[model samples]
Each structure stands twice: as C-alpha cells, then as structure tokens.
Target: MNVIKRATAPTPKFFKLLRNIGLSIAAAGGALMTAPAGLPHGLVTFANYLIVAGTILSAVSQITTLNDE
Candidate 1:
C-alpha cells in the first residue's frame, strides 16, 4: 500500500493509545520550549529530545495497520 493509504488506514487500539500519548508528549515539549525566561538549559534540551521522540512515536503508530487474517 502507498504511504497515504497506510497512514489513513485503521490503526490498532494499542497504537491509537500510543499515538495519543505521543501527541501529548510533543505538546508538553512544545509548551516547555516556548516558555519565557528562567527555564534551565537542560530542560530545553530535554524538550527538544521529547519533540523528536514524540514525532517518531506518533508517526510510527499512525502508520501501523492490522494484518488480514
């Protein structure tokens, strides 16, 4: 199947949960990154990593599909 098709296809329950979690993680990271002064450098770096990891997790989860029995 094509990328679009696979992405739009139905995802498993577990993956749906994972995708939601990933999205939440990304959102949290974004908020952290956008926060005003006083934020530690380490937190900013962690937020960047969170964004990357969340993006990857959500993308992978979104493309997963159930196999035909």
Candidate 2:
C-alpha cells in the first residue's frame, strides 16, 4: 500500500517551470548588471531582487526534485 501510494503520487511540473523561470530571471539580472553606469537607480534594485528570487526558486526546485526521487 505504501509503495502503491508513492507510485500514484503526482509529480509536480510547477517546480520544473519555476526552475526554468528562475534561470531566466537570474540571467536577465546578470545581463542588467553588465550595463554601463548612469542607469536608473531602481534597475539595480530590481536586478538584485531577480537574482535572489531566481536563486531561491532554483534551490527549491533542486531540493524538491531530490526528495521526490
């Protein structure tokens, strides 16, 4: 019963999407960081936020994937 229960559980597709989105976001943030100075002040803040968010999402995805297996 325990084996059957585990086998019947649905794998989360959302986590894969989250991981991809996170990679894109982090890449965008990195690209933004490479721009020349004199850019808008908020850009850096936004970029930093994206980087952090991406990192978190990627980490969550990896952790969940590992546990799921």
Candidate 3:
C-alpha cells in the first residue's frame, strides 16, 4: 500500500499586512478618545471612522484566513 499527501497553500501575505495595519489604526483611534484635552470635533469624527474601518478590515481578514484552513 502507498500513501500520498498534498501540501496546503500558504496564507496570502496581504491579509497579515491588513490585520497589522488595522490594529495600529484602531489603537491610534482609541488613544485619541483617551487624550486628556480631547480631540477636535472633526478629528474625533475621523478617529471614529478609523476605528470602524479598522474593525471591519480586521474582521474580514480573520474570516478569510480561517476559511483558507
């Protein structure tokens, strides 16, 4: 009897990059929220957008990566 195995494909590189960037953006957004003086209204709005976008990107990356397994 003979057995054979096939190697799986590696994860795409951009997903990892997306996850790291998303984390950094989210952290920056959180830091803005915690500043003592508080950020300007426009900047706060931008920070909120960043956090949302980052969370979305991170979730997408995670779901896609898991599916590849």
Who wins the lDDT comparison? 1
TM-scores for all candidates? Answer: 0.93, 0.68, 0.71
Stretches of candidate 3 off by over 4 Å are 1-11, 66-69
- Candidate 1 wrongly placed segments (more than 4 Å): none
- Candidate 2 lDDT, tens digit per residue, 3-54? 4453445436887788788889998998888888766879988998888998
Write the candidate numbers in order of decreasing TM-score: 1, 3, 2
Task: Residues 1-69, candidate 3: write the lDDT tens digits.
Answer: 111111132335787788788888888888887778957899989889988988888766644432333
Best by TM-score: 1
As for TM-score, the candidate ahead, 1 or 2, is 1
The weakest ten consecutive residues by lDDT in model 3 span 1-10
Candidate order, lDDT descending: 1, 2, 3
Question: Per-residue lDDT for 18 in model 2?
Answer: 81
Q: Flag the better candidate by lDDT, 1 or 3.
A: 1
True-structure RMSD for candidate 2: 7.0
Off by over 4 Å in 2: 1-12, 66-69
